[model samples]
Target chain A: MSWLLALPFFIPITTALIAFLARGRKHLCSVISITGCFAALCVSIAIVTLVVSGGPQAAQMGDWQAPYGITLIADRLSAVMLLISAIVGLCVALFAISDINENRVKLGFHCFFQLLLAGVSGSFVTGDLFNLYVWFEVMLIASFALLVLGGEKIQLDGGIKYVALNLVSTLLMLTSIGLLYGLTGTLNMAQLHISLAEVDNPVAISTLAVIFICAFGIKAAIFPLFFWLPASYHVPPVAVTAVFAGLLTKVGVYALIRTFTLIFPNDLGFTQNILLGAALLTMLTGVLGAAAQYEFRKILSFHIISQIGFLILGLALNSPLALAGTVFYMIHNIVAKTNLFLISGTAQRLAGSYELNEIGGLYKASPLLSTFFFIAAFSLAGFPPLSGFWAKLLLVKASLDQTAYFVTAVALITGALTLFSMSKIWAEAFWKPHPQGHCKSLYSLSVAERLQRLLPVSLLASITLILGFMPEPFIEYALGTAGELLHPDDYLEAVLTGSSH
Target chain B: MNSIILQTATRVLVALILVFSVYMLLRGHNYPGGGFIAGLIAASAFALFAMAWGMEAAQSALRIPPGNLAVSGVALAGLSGLMAIFYGDGPFSGQWLTLIGAKEEDGIVISNVLFFDIGVYLTVLGAVLTLIFALEEAS
Candidate 1:
């Protein structure tokens, strides 16, 4: 049973090895990757169940214990995150098999895709801060490769900026690990949790906290630090871009929550204020950035920045309820965001362009796509009855409870802006007529192309709806996970106690 | 492809990076550096040699693409974390051994974490070098 915890990271990696050695068989490589995704998903779920039934599991490499040995811990928070990452990774992998062209496949797309998943899953499950940084690099390296899969002028240009910025983040994070180790004596997350609380110089601790925030914040694509994402995310194949939209930056957000909640809980006073204000600005900037865009994928990329603010508000509030909302929002955002990207790709397939000016009257072209698009759009905009609604409801209620009037107002306003931005996409890309000139140039798809295109995305779309309707189980788990985070004594005990045991 | 002296130096430096990377990983637990810094240090060594020699010559000489080095490094590093599952330590627990004898009596038997560090070392060295090589070749 304990062997299952290793599967999520191991399966893809092994399959990746096999895929790489398949001697240029592109079809076999893709099939191997998709199979790895499903296996990882099942293992992720089993690990969560194991954590729930048998209690938290800690493993020390080579029989060497912690403080002396590097450790991996699968606590409630990490197991739940592993599950979420597996879902997103699996859905995107399946979607990519169909949406990715054969030309792109020859570009080592499967290799990059598998590496990205490995990096992401490693980040979710690792217990050491240093290991997490390596995982970050893993993901970033793969992302850079994927973003420029075709090596086009725009991709290379945009990928350069993305790579440089991320490299800086990695350098900063590595330095912070040095700082934390120099200051406190451990890179183990639980040990750091215990050690950081004992450090007396309030100022030094606060400075370290800010450094961590900057390091992770860049990855999350928060405001004032998010320009690189929209610049580069739009350059990749639609499937690759869509998955990055769903997963990459969210890892940053996850790091923020993990660090703030676990490593620096005692020093949240000034940092939380800064993060709170940044959240509002991020929300506005993202939606506004979306509004200013005429390209379909670019608009969604901008919105990613804005929606992250909602997730951050939960962490900034620093309460159980707010944390739960943050968790819920992260889940809802992944599903809805992936859905939008996939559907938008479908729109591109049928309509022939991502430029809104060139793509109009989606309602006239295909009713089914518009319906699915509407579901994802409304859910993203925080409309009631969907999962997005409940997440926002939790966040809003938490804000009001804390009497954070500024954020409360900002949340409602952001909701409006979100709705407005999504509608612009629907109207311009779906409702409005593709002016006579553009319509004449539309690309027609073969019947098989259409079916191959719709099946995987539709499966994901249905998952989004089902989760939205039955969010109770998920919500309860989120509340529990958030609770464990706020009260991380259990996590501390899991690591520290295991070392002594 | 030009001169024997320069080619010899590149080979020496690449070997040096590999050794230096290991030293850093083992020294990390108690000192200023650890697996990550050591890994990068080693990688940088390879990168410097790659810069000195052409990327193609380096890739072929290594007998495999550096990209695979990066990929395998990540997998090995992750497997290092999963090492704890076999023991009862939970997920990513630290496994350190303090070996006694020879010149350094208090020397620790480097655990698989060093292997993890080497993994990172290769990945960093390979990934950045591959990228730089690709960009350079493209131009």
Candidate 2:
């Protein structure tokens, strides 16, 4: 049974190995990777179903009891995250087959890709705080390789800044983990909860809490620390950047939500107010930054920062509805943002450049691609009857309930500005005539390439539509997950239980 | 710098270091020696070989690319964890088999833990050598 929890990451590890061994066989590697990801997706869905029906499940590594051994726990929050991650992982792996070139495949792209997925899955499922740190390092190393794999001048430039800043964040996280360990002699998150409460130093706790906020905040790309994201995200290939955009920062957000809710429950008045202020600035800066960018992917990268503000707002509000909103928003944002990146990649291929001024006639050439870009873009802008709209509605209502009118106002205005940015891209990239006077339409591509690229975008776009149309079940799930996050009793009980179940 | 005396000494030293690294790896289960230090020690021996005999000699000595070795190491490590599934235990759960059974703790015990340690040893050694070899070849 415990093996079930380990399979999500293990499948990726094995796939990476097989793919590495089948080095020159690109088709075989792609087949191995996609099948492995598909299998992991199935496992993730199974875990979610089990968690939803049977409550949280915890598996102790090597049959050792918790608080002494590594633990993998699957509660509603983790289960939902695992499911979304699997969906994104499978989609990205499929997209990479045709999108990535032969040179990259020969250079171990598929191996590192699987390793990155393994890291993401590991981070979501591990119940040990120290283990989470290890997973973060795994993700960092894999992503670093993916970023600079091509060894282009621009990639190296971007990789340097990305590595430098992320390393600083890693340093901060380690320091705080050390401090926490000193405060409580345990690293297990479930036991940390009890041990932290026993800590007599309120000041030390708050200080450590602030340090954690900064550490995770950097990772999440919140306001002041987000420059690295826009600088580097546009450097990688579209498939690589898509996964980075969708999952990497979200891991940071997940860490924030986990720590703020579980470890630093005290000093809310101080910590939360700081978070609230940061959220507003992050939202304002991200949208304004997006507005300034004329390149396609650059704009989307900035918007990621803006969207992170909304997820943080949910945490800042600290309401059940607000938390649920963040949960829903995370799923929505991951799909929408990834689809937009994939669209930008397709647009880059279609028009031969990522510059907004250079790329145009996409709508005239292929309405299907334009339609996808429109759905994903507008959905990101929180248009009604879309998934982002429901996400916005929940946060807005939550803010109003708390009588935080300023936050509500910022939320609405950010939505309007997000729409403006989306329209700017639409008008420039899609509606405008091509500067070169001619461009290949999507239909001009071979069927295989089109199928490889379009299939993932179409599938993800349909998910956004489905979530928008029938959000009842998803909302219920998010709400239930939020309840579990707020009250981690089930999580703690499962982790602290003596035997593996 | 390309002295015959240095090359001869390196050849002898490399063999000694390789043997000692394996001892360190095996002794790690119960003593201070472990996979990481053993791997580093092994890598240093190859580094010395590279310095003495030139890049081509070091490359041929390894016989496989360090990247391939690293991948195989990771595969071995992962498979070691999967061994526990046959025993209905968690991933990486240690399953011990005593060769001469009769009394508890009186025989040579073979376990998945040792396999895991060996995996880690190879992974570190391969990864470290890959980076150094690439840099050396480039230069």
Candidate 3:
């Protein structure tokens, strides 16, 4: 059982080792990477199935009992997140075959990529707070390497900002963890849940909660701290950007959700207002930033911030339905956002630049690519019968149910602004005639390159479509997850009462 | 660097530091020293060697790319964890072997924890050297 839980990250670490050793051989390294991601995806699916059937699963490392040793626990939330992230990881690995150049591959791109996935999976499944911090560092290092892989002037500039701010966040997170551990005498999250409830220091707990929000907020790119995201995300290779766009911030948001729900479930009166205010500002500033962007990937990067706002808003609302909305929105955003970055890469490949005004005629050169862009972009904009629409609907309904009219207004306005930005990209990048009088068609790409690039984009777009068209099962699953989160008795039981031996 | 005294002293110092590092690593599980500090000690030896002789000389002395060595160390540590699974225990559970005695506690006790520690030793040694070498070369 523990091995099953461990495989999602374990396989990736092993793959990273092999891929690094095989770095001199491009094809073999990519094959190993893809196979590793596929295996992780399979493990994730098995874990999800097991969690669904068996309630929740927990494992103690080194046979140490809970509250003492490291524990890895997976409820519905962790399992589903693991599954979705694995899918994104595999898709990005497929796309990297063509998108990454030989120089980068020789620099051990596959190894770092797998390591990044391993970190992400570890972050999702670990049941210890300090373990989460370790996973975050793993992610930080791997992502820093990926961001600055080429060491281009632009990339280095971006990487410095990214690393600088993230390090501050890390320091704050570590401090907060230390404070919490001192207060509760436990680093295990489930144990903390029980220990915290017994404590009466409301002021200290509230302070720690705010510090946590600041730490994770920086990572989630919530308003004020989001500058690093746009500055850095656009500078990486599209495959790198795509995976970062898909999984990284969501991990931050996931941490926010987990900590808020599991350890700090009460204290709503204090934390709720702060989270709500941050969420509103995050949505507004992010969309406005996107509106001002004329670059392809930059616009998408800003939207990621805006979307993170909605996820946090769900957590702030603190209803079961609202948390469910957060889950649904996260999945929707990961698929749609990743797909958009990938399509931007394809669009750049076709039209020669990522600057909006410099490229056009995508619709004329290849309607198929344009259609893919439209599906992903409009889905991001909350078009009805699309995934984003349902995700927004859930949040909107959840907000209205709570009589949070102001929150609903901000959410809807942000949705409209998001649509405006997507249409801007459409008008400038896709719908117009080429400024240079020529745009390359998809047919110009070699068949292998075409397959490598387009297949992931198409698969992600189809996932967006599936979630939009058939959201019943996913919505139900999310509701169940929210129930578990709201009442963490089962999670606590799984982690604390389960036999370590 | 051109001083013969510094180079000659480094030759003797590197060997001593390395042996001490191994000693620290071996006594780590029950004592104050462990893989991490031992690794730092060993890496400083190479750093001193690099400073005295230069990066290429240190690289040759190491006999493997630090990056590869670091990766293999991680693989070794991970594989050590997997050993517990084969013994019908959870991943990372310590498994012990008595190589020299009849009783469990009376023998020369060895455990997977030692392997795990060794793995950590190699990883830190390699990683620190990788950084130090890069910095030295860059400068």
Instruction: Give the clash count for model 3.
Output: 0
TM-score of chain A of each: 0.96, 0.99, 0.99
lDDT of 2 by residue, A387-490 (tens): 99999999999999999999999999999999999999999988999998887888889999999999999999999999899999999999998898889998
Instruction: Give the native contact fraction of candidate 2.
Output: 0.93
Docking class of 1: incorrect
Native contacts matched by each model: 0.19, 0.93, 0.89
Ranking by lDDT: 3, 2, 1
Q: Model 3 lDDT vs. the true structure?
A: 0.94
Candidate with more favorable, higher TM-score: 1 or 3: 3
CAPRI-style quality class for the chain A–B interface of candidate 2: high
Per-residue accuracy of model 1 over A388-411 as CA lDDT, tens digit each: 898999999999999889889999
Distance (Å) between predicted and true CA of B84, model 3?
A: 0.4
lDDT comparing candidate 2 with the true structure = 0.92
Of 1 and 2, the candidate ranking higher by TM-score: 2
Give every collision pair in model 3: none
Query: Highest DockQ among the candidates is held by which one?
Result: 3
Off by over 4 Å in 2: B103-105
Between prediction 1 and prediction 2, the one with superior DockQ is 2
